[model samples]
Target: MSTQEERSGRYLDFYRDNIERISENSSPYINSFRQNAIEEFKKLGIPTRKNESYRYTNLDTFFGHPYSSYFMPSEPDFVKAEEFRCDVTDLDAHGVVLINGFYPTITGKLRELPGGIWIGSLSEASRKFSGMIEQHYGRYVNGNSDGLVHLNTALASDGVFLWIPEGVSLGKPIQIVNLVNSDQDIFNQHRNLIIAEKNSDITLIICDHTLSPQKFLTNAVTEIHVGENAHFNIIRVQNEHNNAAKITHTFIHQERNSVATSNNITLHGGLVRNSTHHYLGGVGAECNSFGLYLSDKFQHVDNYVNVDHAFPSCKSNQLFKGVLDDMATGAFNGRIYVHPDAQGTMAYQKNSSILLTDDAKMDTKPQLEIYADDVKCSHGATVGQLDENALFYLRSRGIDKRQARLMLMFGFAHEVLQNINVEALRERMDNLVMQRLKGELSRCASCMVKCV
Candidate 1:
């Protein structure tokens, strides 16, 4: 067998051997879908460049490493959860922690706050809210053919589950911190479900971090449902070490008159791929997607976005920017699809990147597929170095070369950063971006978990 097939076979054998353990703590409703998902995974296997969606990223390199999968919940350490401090200060938000893809038994399995908000483990929520889980758990990912999605569905045990009741507006944002801390190479898969009921509003902040130097591979899937006239905002911050590979798939469905926004900031990683799918299924639905990535050394980052306009009067906008230094590489793929019956659809996409070194590389593809005649759509991409004219203008004004370059890079990245609605988060991200541009390591200074 070829090397790719050998690597893929490992996972197939793994699922066969651990199927019972994987389903041990899961509910019947969740376990019922595992068999079919694994069958689909067998047909798809691990994705390679042959797959158009995964053309820019080659998963074989990351999957070749031998890593132990986390099938059951690890020993809970509430002390670590309580002692951990978020890099973002003055941001008063509810905190939830997940260690190696399992929610720690911190404060019961589920925590229900005022205003009828539920935040806690997905496995626990599966037992308590079976009706809700059955309705939305696999709904968004039902028709997906991606191997990673199927693999996650087959093996994922627990993750974050959030529910905002109808007509309720959360006073504070929900912050979720996912940490991978282990002595040996580890493979993790976590699934998250978020429901925003009719007329409800909420903001979510997701942070991904690695606390150990061991090789870590994480595959995370999140499904979000926005009810009629509701609003949901999510900001994702990823900061891991060079020995980590992180893959995230997020599926969002918006209902009538609903508004949703997603902002992703990628700081450091060995390999990172973020795939986001947005479905505007109701009239007057709107979504805005933005991302910023900074990478140096041998790191790689990829962002993929697909927006579907299935109803009339829907709108979407995608803007992504990246800064690559040394031998780093990046990719951005943005696609907008408008159905034939969806009239009055407005969609736009743009991707821009700056390469600091001759060896740094970037690949961008912006696509638009519209079947409606009256719809408006546009797409564009740019890959180039910082404008010499701008840099020269700054240097002539008595600014040093290094500082001038940092200023120009930050200015380019600020376009995507400005869209962050949370003032505290925006400021913290701004500082982090500057630090990244100044050649500093992307470690969270205030985080209690130390890396090797």
Candidate 2:
């Protein structure tokens, strides 16, 4: 019943012994960065079934696996562009690709971006713009995170760094391809930071591409700093192979009058956990988020979303929906906090899911902590199935039982998908969903829609 830290995990002891050795004071780029993180990781250790946030998912074997550094990647694993293929991409978009958590060679040239925007590798940013990294890195995250986040900071070796100067907007979206293809059991902590100054706009695509059979762990952290009048759209697509385990933390920091839109989509992952936290630090800022998760077979997904309205006149709207079949398990926890100073704030949150199989399980919690009396906020959660009445009506109309079920199920997901603004993304998601409705998505379901 308790979610507090347990005294029995050895990872914490590992951290107590290793934190000082891996302290950043030695130099952010110390060669031992990964080892330092490993020390902290041992201290913080992986979360157990006891941690309130991790109560639904257990990592007994995940942490028990041996750790190996991917710092010096050898020859390319020949799973080149054609084999671990990505769907077609629009050439005009700003594309940034990562292979196995490291930046990869660009086969195609990129068009010149807006004049004031600079997109480069984190190494370049750390060497030239230490000021920015110092001011913003881990600024919004809880510094006391047992050791998961600290390990991420310590072990991070590759990521994207984006900066937008004042008054400039990049209309096209920037795609970040995060690939995982290690030959052995590996743990990679990747970090990315994006800063949008006054009056600029940008969109980011975070894709998880996998092609490895080894047990892998990805603790990815992305920090976004949204300044005055800036607008940002962050889209995350998870399609990792079944053998991968990925945990992500995306932090959004907003200033006055800025807007942040975060879209989380999960189609496949062996064991995926996404933690998205937003801090509305500026007055008049607005935030909107939509998430879609589909889990089948033995896959497991856990999402934790937190929003902190620290200033007045801010607004946020969030909705997360999931579809689970077979023996898959899913969890959703959303928290919105209205601080004492955040008066006149308006916020709404909703979490919903549908389990098609009797063995499928979904647990959702929608929470609100309001310290301000002058705020309007509401939250709701639901777990149910396709409407039997709707199915019956369709069946009465001579529609086949399978077609009727597929239509109703697609209708359920449409509530969340309709909010997407990107036409291509919407179309792609539609196809994936239809694959499910048509019963061509996977083989684990018994009563599935047949796709042509």
Candidate 3:
């Protein structure tokens, strides 16, 4: 067998050897689909450059490492959890921490807020809220052909679960911090579910960080359901060391008259692939997706987005921007699909990037597939360097070359950053982006490990 095949076989063997243990730790509701998921993973195997969706990235390099999988819940480090603070300063929000993809026990299994809001562990919710879990658990991504998604479904044990009751609005946003800290190379998988009932409003923030220097690979999946007339928003920040590889899949379904927004900011990682699928299943549904990525050195970041308008009178928008320096590489593939019966659809997609060096590369594809005659859709992409005249304008104004370049890059990134509705979070991200452009630490100031 080739080296890639050997690496793939190791996971298959590991799953087979520990199937019993894996099933024993998980609830039957979650275990019911493991067999089928594993079978699908076997048929698809690890994704390679040959896969059309994965053509721009090479997964073999990240999977080739021998890493220990976390199938069972480990003991929670209460001391660490108590002392750890989020990088975003003074943000008044409910905080949830997941260490090595397992929800820490110190925070309790589940928390119920005053407004009928539920936040806690996914495993506990699976058992306690089996009816709700069964109704929406695998609905969005069950038929997906991605092997990595299936592998995560088969191996995932615990993650965050959030529920907002009907007609209620959360007083504060909920922040979920995922930390990977281990002595040895580790592979972790976590599954999250969020439900916003009818007429409810909520906001969520997700932060991914690596606290140890060992090689880490994390495969995370999140499923979100927005009820009719509900509002939901999410912001994700990814910051990890060059030794970490992070893959995330987000599936969102919107009901009639619902509104949902998703923003992703990627700062540092060895390899990062983010796949987002938005399904507008009801009339008057709206979704806005935005992303910004800054990569340098050999870091790689790929973003794939698919938006489906299945009903009439729905609106969708996508704007993704990236800045690549040194030999960094990036990719953005965005698709907007409008159903035949979906008339009066307004969809727009745009991808723009700036390459700072000759070795820095970017591949962007913005596509729109419309079957409806009365719909308006547009897609475009741009990949180039900064404007020389603009840089010279700053130079003529007595600004140094380094500061002028940083100003241009930050201006390019600010378009996406300004879309953030949370003022405090936006300001914090602004500072973080400047630090990253200045070649400072790519990690959060509060984090223990200093990985550039």
Best by lDDT: 1
Q: Kindly list the per-residue Cα lDDT of model 2 for residues 1-452, writing each as its tens digit.
A: 32224422444544445556434322364334456555665666566766777778766556665566455354464235223434734324677766666555344212236666777666556666777777766565545353566667665665777888888877677777776666587877677878888898888888786655577878888888998999888888887756678898888989999999998888777788888888898999999878888888888998888899999999999899888988999998888999999999999999888899999999888878999999999889989988888999999999998889888878777777776666777777777777866657552121111211
The candidate with the higher lDDT, 1 or 2, is: 1
Model 1 residue 142 CA deviation (Å) reads: 1.6
Tell how far residue 327 is off in model 3, in angstroms. Answer: 0.5
Q: Is candidate 1 or candidate 3 better by lDDT?
A: 1
Clashing pairs in 3: none
Q: Specify the poorest-scoring 10-residue window by lDDT in model 2.
A: 443-452
> How many backbone clashes does every candidate have?
0, 5, 0
The lDDT per prediction is: 0.89, 0.74, 0.89
Query: Using lDDT as the measure, what is the rank order of every candidate, best first?
Result: 1, 3, 2
lDDT of 3 by residue, 1-452 (tens): 25656866888887898888877767898998888888888888888888878889987777987787655445645446646788777688998888878777776889998698999889999988888899888787867888999998888878898989899898788899998888889898899999999999998999998888889999999999999999999999998989899999999999999999999999888999999999998999999999999999999999999999999999999999999999999999998999999999999999999999999999887767899999988888999999899999999999999999999999999999998878888999888898988988666556678665
Give per-residue lDDT, candidate 3, residue 309. 96
**Model 2, residue 83: C-alpha shift (Å):** 8.6
- Which segments of model 2 are wrong by more than 4 Å? 1-43, 75-85, 89-92, 105-112, 142-146, 442-452
Question: For model 1, how does the per-residue alpha-carbon lDDT over 108-143 read when each residue is reduced to its tens digit?
Answer: 889998798999999999999999999899999879
RMSD, one per candidate, in order:
1.5, 5.1, 1.5
Error of 3 at 259 (Å): 0.9
